[model samples]
Target: MLSLKKIAIPMLTLLLVVSAIGLTNAAPSTQAIETLNIGFMQAPSSTGDFGVRLAIDQINREGGIVGPDGALYRLQVVYPNRPPFAPDGVPDAVTSLVAQKAIAIIGPVDNRLAFPNLEVLAQAEVPVLTLATTDALTELDPSDNIMRIRAADRFYNEGLATVLIDERAITSFALIQTDVDSTEALLGFEGILVNRSLTPTVKIQEIDNSNLQADAERILQGAPAAVVMWGPPEDAETLLLRLRENGFTGLFVYRDAQEAVRSGAIPISLARGMMGATSWSYTTPTELGRAFLVDYVTSFNSIPTGVEAAAYDAVWILRRQIEQTGGDITKLREGLLQTPTIYAVQGRLEPSTYGGGDFSRAVTVYTMGDLGGPQLVARFANNVRLGDDDLVATDVRVVGLAGTLTYTPSPSPTPTLTPIPSATPSEVTLTVPQESVNLRAGPGTEYEIVGQLQLGDTATVIGSNADFTWLVINHEGQTVWVAADIVDVFDPGNLLSQLPIVQPGTNNPGIEPGQLSEGIDLTIEGVVLSPPQISPGQPFTVQVTVRNLGVNAAGSFSVSAILQPGNLTITAGSTGLGAGQSAIVTLNGTVDGTGSYTSSITVDATNAVLESNENNNVFPLTYVSDRPILSRIDFVQIPVGTAFDFAGGTADMIWTGTQIEGQNNARFGIVYAGAFEAVDYNAIDPSVVINFILPGSNIGTGSLIGFITAEGRRGVMRVDSLVGTALTVSYRVYSN
Candidate 1:
């Protein structure tokens, strides 16, 4: 529990009376009286708080949250020790933190744990400092106060993309998600690629691995560059071992970095160089990183991982906010809006691309080697390219991916099934001895002629249409029929020649999976579900979804909304049924949107999934546009030293401009530092726009300024030296 002691100043007359009565010594005044309480919510067993606590104390120790001569303050740290957070159980600690009157709380270490109590935090206006796992909890923008300190899931997924291009030589991909929502959000990856016209050759599937052999058979049929897997490490280990033992040696990509490390999914030697995306930049701006290392060692008595460091950043950021705003929420919001670029051990916290809000944070790419080891950062880029090859090795040199993994099977799956039918019959024509012949249904005459066979209709003679029956001379076409006993006949064409057809269902164009191909407008959602086991009866359930919103079902009726699971297979992506009808389809994929992820259906369809009625199909897409919303500089890409003029005004910001959201998938980039300037630092006014909130002076339609955005409505965007936040969303759209 925190120590928040409210000192009551006795009446001045009483004090004078006490002084006169010589009771002054008994009432020696108390110091650190206006105890400022900050909440710290975290898993009971988590060590992440060690660093966070230290950071909070350190910042406070220097000068509390007060100015040089302003009223100084003290903070009492409270741990709502609830449950085995790193272990299990709904974190009762979150409730405890709220009870403690903590202005800002930090550390739940994992997404799953943080999500359950979002409502509680939202009601309290207490922001969450993300400590661990990109469980999609941080992104669901419930309130401006619920900010995250951790790097998000997009980085890991994006880093995986870079890994495929560099180490795996992946030109094409077939992304296979499991029944986990955190991983399914990858559908936005294509949206990220498409805004720039990059197309990934891919096949995305949702699977029912009831029969691994059968599932494997289907997946193996379509060879891909590499398979992107987003399941638990344990499940991945099982799947990878099975696929590898089954002889799938192609590149196998792991979603979360730790998953790969634990499962040993890839070559141990190549482990370090593995690309991972996360808001926590494990290796960037090495100075803050090195200092954090020393402090972490001293405080925790052990080394901290990027995830842990991220949690620490969350707490520090909160402490900073509290100090800057003097514990007033009005200042808290404004300060957050005006925040400057923050470079903690974790990646920088910039704005998101969606509507300029604190909901979105920047995602930085990292290469994880080993704990306590130097990790490197991959520079930002539109998409990973060839010249970037050297950049990969430089980031995390510990795991040197020396060679490329080209999928050329030593003994590829070559099905040598020579199905030669047991019998080979000859084609024949017949003539009748008599004027007319009867056509029997059966060759032996036991069967009757159900219908008449016309002459020149090329019906099989079959011993005559009817056994022992006589046929009249055919019509004036000059064709004659023979008597049943008079006709001579032989073999007939094989009765059947067509393959069995798979029943068709209504079609829906979901998030299509492939390599960066020409960007196709897609509707994608973020969801959380259970791990899909190849064997049934795993007590699996998927709950909570946040989707890209839109209208206009694109495909035909009776066709299914397909899901493709890659190395970790889901189901088929394409289903051809009748047209214009709806059906329900349960897919197994992952949900890894940047921050805001909740339990709701990603898409609305008869068969695909049923989203909550409250949701208006909000897909994660955003854009910056207006006649003068953006500024076009005199010269583009001008030298850094050149001065530029940017008109300033309030322009419309459509984080996702499309009427329907999420079709235009975007990867929001932010560059703003949390700040509030222009007036005296102590001025606390909501009406005054923070310096960072202003996008360039007057940019044309395409550019935007600082407005923290999520994949949905927030992230970081820089406007000149004054960095800001912006959002990149993948929204769906109907016919305009």
Candidate 2:
């Protein structure tokens, strides 16, 4: 979905520059090319390595740069291990680089790790092109020795606000952050909303290992439209997983922490649909950008991250400065300060000397992709270019005065003057490339493959995804879509805008059961029996009703009566039935012992009949099989609130105390009204009440406790002790 504004350069020309750079030679130097020391920490593992290396390799292949003394110079990169979070590791590493006469440094990508090393580099007066996002990092040196190629924290905040408000139109969201710098980043984003005169409620919280789940719950309670997070990669990823587990389905705005989310810390399913902002993305549009992607992947077997892309541009920027100043360090510094803009792979590169200056191509908003990697959704260009009124509130510090160092407006960079192609309304068409392309039911690969567009096949555009990465085409009146990359658009004018911007799967969310139209309709109407109650070992006759409501005749289906204790017998069944027909089937069953038996009558016992409503094809009959009558027993003496070792001593049920019992206590008893029957006991709901009375204690009026007897039968006892001299407890029990 991301649309980049770029110069209309030929793709072939761009490719040649990217791939054939090494073959071209710069003016030859008189002296042996001088080597400039540049340092990198965690070399191969660092995100900035590939870009830096790729750029340097290309420059060296082009005969490097000529120095002021007519000698050519090439960059010599030194790697020192600076394990993350080591207190003195980064400073020591930078010191070592300085001792090696390193002119400038490319990175320490992490803000926390990069922060502590700033003072050391500043004191050494060595300008660093860091990838860290902390806004305060730039303010560390008054002379501006640090030229940040990545967007500062505040710019990322602005980018988030831009996406939430300008693009998504979301009014309310939750804000979560971790680590120390998150506070400043969160505040900056809040300022953007306030400036727009919109005060939508925001639920703000801090999260860490201990409160990750709890804080996620708190955020979910707000029912936010989305959640914005700022933190270290790990912390950010942890919170994202927690939110998903708690069913927090809303937009997720991750800031400058893609490294963590993309690190496979979260399951791919849960990670899908997550959105984030970054300074650079591997899915760049330019041909040069494509070259970097292919070269990096082939070389490293991994995706190049935003940090690496910024470092890549940093090398080129430094290389250009070196060429202009002929390797004079002081002159190079001046050139870096004075240059308005330098075009590179990330588009126009702009750095500022002002406080908290912004970088031009800083923030791109992207969503987690289904097939692989990120799907760029939108881009929020840096609005705070130098001499652009310094938009957004920033603290101004005048470093000098009249006849001294005075504050003055820095000159604006020369804007690239290539004419942007204009779109004219015309018929839109797409041509498949040299290979067969899959046409899917939706825009993403997650959608089902509906058809294929062969090489050179052309289709008229009906719609497209918002990102412009996919095109919806009509193939023989069937709606299908294809990826926009492998196809060329042949719009007469600009017809892409006329198509509807539809999201994948939006039109086909789901189908309901009632929507199904192709299946037989069958139902168990009712069950009738002659003499529903009988003594133990007695037999009963049952009649069942079944109906076929489908359009076609129902297939041969068997109906069977299954007794609860585990006996099954085929009863009256139908070989076939025409639409709107009903049949009565008969079943016979005998109970082995006295108890309540459930006669379950099911049509299509083997599931041979595909019914429209399978759930309604079964019916149940509760038949009572009472036991032989038994004599009642009278209660002699039992203590109230005392345990009763009943049920053959296998279990205990009693009013142990007057204290209310918790629902979880298995021994708690309840009373129910009615004379208990062995066949009807299972029908009674256990009401935990008094089961026994204390000696000489009067039984409370209207008291009853329904319980199971020691013989595994249900029983009910009623005491008439409220008026009698002795306790009188009568019981009626039944076998289950």
Candidate 3:
């Protein structure tokens, strides 16, 4: 929740300024005062919002933008009441901003939040200044409204690859994708390498931190000259630590290594000599960038990151365009496109040939200094035009004295073809025996199916579960898991023990399950909701199992369950627990929300008990009411050939969710039922069968349809209106 002081202070100051203006103007004036609402998607205290607020204040102080109609428009920042990453939060925030008549929107900086809601923001028909660096956003935007303020990930990928291949002269490289967001980075880097007539020695995709050790071992086996990774800072740090611990001496490069070091996820000692790339750096040589850094630091009492710089630049750019266009909302996009370039804090803002909205092409490569800071090594202006399949980077140059550093390759033993009689085989393979086996995302049936292997299809095994119940295999270049029972082991050398134990998608670091810790370590083993689905305001019990895995005993500690949106808090406490002891703490609470509520359970709410790792104390449990959650899709007009994914909660053609398209997850074209009237939400049963076939051309307004999501949750859709190929509908999805 945003604090009143944070929002009210600026508004109050604006009010006083307006009042002063009115008092001072004794004579009648032709100019009328209006408010220009600017929507911000991040939290009020976030760096992006801070930059926006500062810009808004400055604009208001300068008497705001003057329209051609002779009206003074004051800038006012608006934020969604909900957190940006929450379910439906982005769309809901966009709706709120549209209602406020916002001329522009700035940031939902995270790629995960921004990518899915591109259509929602585009539908608003307002310029959205996005700080997210994912290159896919340029391709994903349905409208020209999404303007990227920062250089896309491909720039960083290109810059990092240049440093590794050109400077280090590393031919053999290993690429690691640590998360879903890293897919584009991994592919972009690989493409750059392939274009340079070099192939990656190893490619590890979607490697979770739980399987970091295994993936590190795989990288070591490849023995590439350098390893380039892209992922979250925490996962990158974990993998780097593991790789280093396993005696890996190869050059390590990650695009987010600076971020990892700043967040203290990776220590400076470990990050020393490692290379990274970023869109912008505080050590920028540009005059405008230097001034921005000074002003931002003086105002906020902190050095600004790339997000802050992008936000500040975005606001200023919008102001300039608005002033030029006379505050005409419809002309903003045209004005931006017609303008050749605008010099701002992030260097030259020129329209990208790849996408209309991508303005900057700046990328900076840096290496960690011995004094625990980033030392600029090189800078690049990536100009690989899109649609031509050109992966070559242009305007690349080395920067600063650090660029002179030379790389010395680690000595390696020559490979031998002769097999040792008693040694285990270096590789293991698996083949599906009788029927097709599902390749899942994790090591369990609950995990989503990513792909499938037919009978006799073979794949090299990379990892396995603790008991080898599920084997991780490279299926069609994707790392997926297959049940060991369904696959026949082709290891004649009996080297099953060589496979590294992996728990995919799990984040339990440093401590394994059922393993005791050296010091006080409290962890939540499991959470069970007595009635998983209940009516709104219905009381429920949350049973959380807390175990002290530490060898040392823990003193008095408390457990709490806080339900979000309603903030319903329930707590229970324990006197003391011995080492290796377990206790079940039950918390009773009633939530008021009709939709989904995430209860965050904390083992030590007040920090009364010290634990070895505090990261595992908080656990999230999502439970929904039995009553269906209602969502409205209004006035969405899509082309006839396109499809809408209901689970994505948008009218966009893209399927952003994990549900496999055309399979269990059917789009609008596959799941449309025949016309029916007066749809009853509660009457629709979860098991009610719906015809899964293409709808007739005559289906239009007043049509009631029932459908099931890929997750097997049933829902009913009611058509409100239809015009040509455009259709408007409302849906109610059941929790069960």
Candidate 4:
């Protein structure tokens, strides 16, 4: 508990008066009040300073914190010129703040700057509220005194994998990350996937000589299912645009460096379809958030980014700590840890073991789309801890708060307990899906077992635990509880939201395997064929989703994609799936013949699974066939680097204003580059080129210009030799 003592000034005044009347020998004393010194780096041009000033103003307006000795004190801001990572700024402005005895540090926002100073600040027992998104900052804090205002880095990794792999079924990808600390930490995540023997693949390619286009072309040539870029906002967006401009039709994923796109630094057309994750979005539906947006825009005349919002929240968090601790800096850390969740402009701010104040908060997955703005595509609530998949490494780093520090919950004296009425005061009907479900005396499985409920047994649920993972029920005239996952609540009503949050015991083992009665439960929810119609020899995708709909988890179930006629089957199965969890099996193969084909996707097709409904385990799919048409061709030559008009041309060259190699006008669907004779046009093969040779290389050609295009379309351009003002050129364009 915080040591907040409110002094009675009147009592002290009376004692002073008595002392003045010669009743005491002690001399009159003056109480000394200490100001809370918060150090932060002030940027020359930033709204960060404004945000801090606003918080300080609001705190002072509410009457500055009153110390235990009836002495009032206020926050004092300290701006240090040399923050960490500045030229020769190794000691940090934090070191100066420490010399001045600062109780807490507010910022020096960049992760590279803040990372090296976290341990130093924590060692001094000074708490920090940083705007950096690096997981390493909090991940390495020994004293758990460093709390991030923004979300950590690991969540971005989780968000990417969740969307690209789990949701989109994109199993293969390439990683191109900038050489930075945050991205460097994310480097070995491929090992996370490999260790688990996961099917999804990720190849991290080194930036070759810092040539983005060259490295990008190399990676895209493999045609990965997706591309994940982690770097500075501009670098990532630029890479995304280059990939798109090159006709790469795969997904792009990134971390929290999305503010650049939000600010429209990157053109909407180029950045469209690029996805990233962030903790807060302007579209958050809350009165506080709405008010914040208005106030921020009015103050700064611009939209607030996540950094500004987080900085604003940091000031408020420190203010609350000051008030709760009665201006005692020693108790500030405890005050922060024990304070109830604060509703801020961003969302509910809560302390987590991750050392971030809002670590477990949900993240909005945003994508720049054709709508000319960023749009929210999905939201993930739970914080994805450091090493969940192959894309994330197992971080031994953690903010160890448990067992060492004693957290005293804020004062809220409980009222006298009373017994409930037996006659179903308020009831919701729920059914236990399996036989022999343990009705524990308490909400968790670790509690004493009271009785057993049979399969299909209906119960009257009166209440639920905080997380709604367990429900209280009336059974045999005794109030008991069953795991919520095993029961189907027919009339949920507002029971979930209305239930008071209660801390569950450590033993809350969700339904265990031995506790379930094996009935029947397996389902093939859907069979989806991508491209619906496949041209001969082109690979089409088949996606099947299998759900474990039973009361218990289904184990080792096989799902097969069966193509009719030859009984060609592509089988994929999962090791296990918990109840309500679905496994999406994606199979890609070519349909060689030109004929309509039907596919039957079946879960447990071999009759190996026993479930509640066996009939619903099959999903039907149909795929159409189409023939590939060859493109038409026209042969003509235009002067290199010369402006040409193709507006009235009979052939569809669709002249783009762009020129290749400073010459050669472009066709709408093709790319061409000209080369001199000394260089081998043979060795110089570009992804966009097809074939090229001067009209006659054997005859002394003045300047041989070679051209190359995509595979489906072939184009040849020859330098017919320089003759007078018209540099004669011959070219033939062919399409399949």
Q: Locate the minimum summed-lDDT window of 10 residues in model 3.
A: 397-406
Q: List the residue pairs that clash in candidate 3.
A: none
What TM-score fits each model? 0.42, 0.48, 0.50, 0.45
**lDDT score at residue 540, model 3, on the 0-100 scale:** 73
**Mind sharing the TM-score for model 3?**
0.50
lDDT of each: 0.37, 0.56, 0.62, 0.51
Q: Which stretches of candidate 4 lie over 4 Å from their true place?
A: 1-35, 42-44, 62-73, 84-90, 99-101, 188-202, 205-209, 262-265, 352-362, 384-736
Q: Best candidate, lDDT-wise? A: 3
- Candidate 2 global Cα RMSD: 33.7
> Per-residue error at 668 for model 2, in Å?
95
What digit string (tens of lDDT, one per residue) describes model 3 on residues 187-212? Answer: 88889998999998889897456777
lDDT by residue for model 2 (54-130), tens: 66655543345544344456665555432233435677777766666677877777676667777765555466777
The parts of candidate 3 lying over 4 Å away from their true place are: 1-30, 352-355, 384-736
Q: Which window of 10 residues has the lowest lDDT sum in candidate 4?
A: 398-407
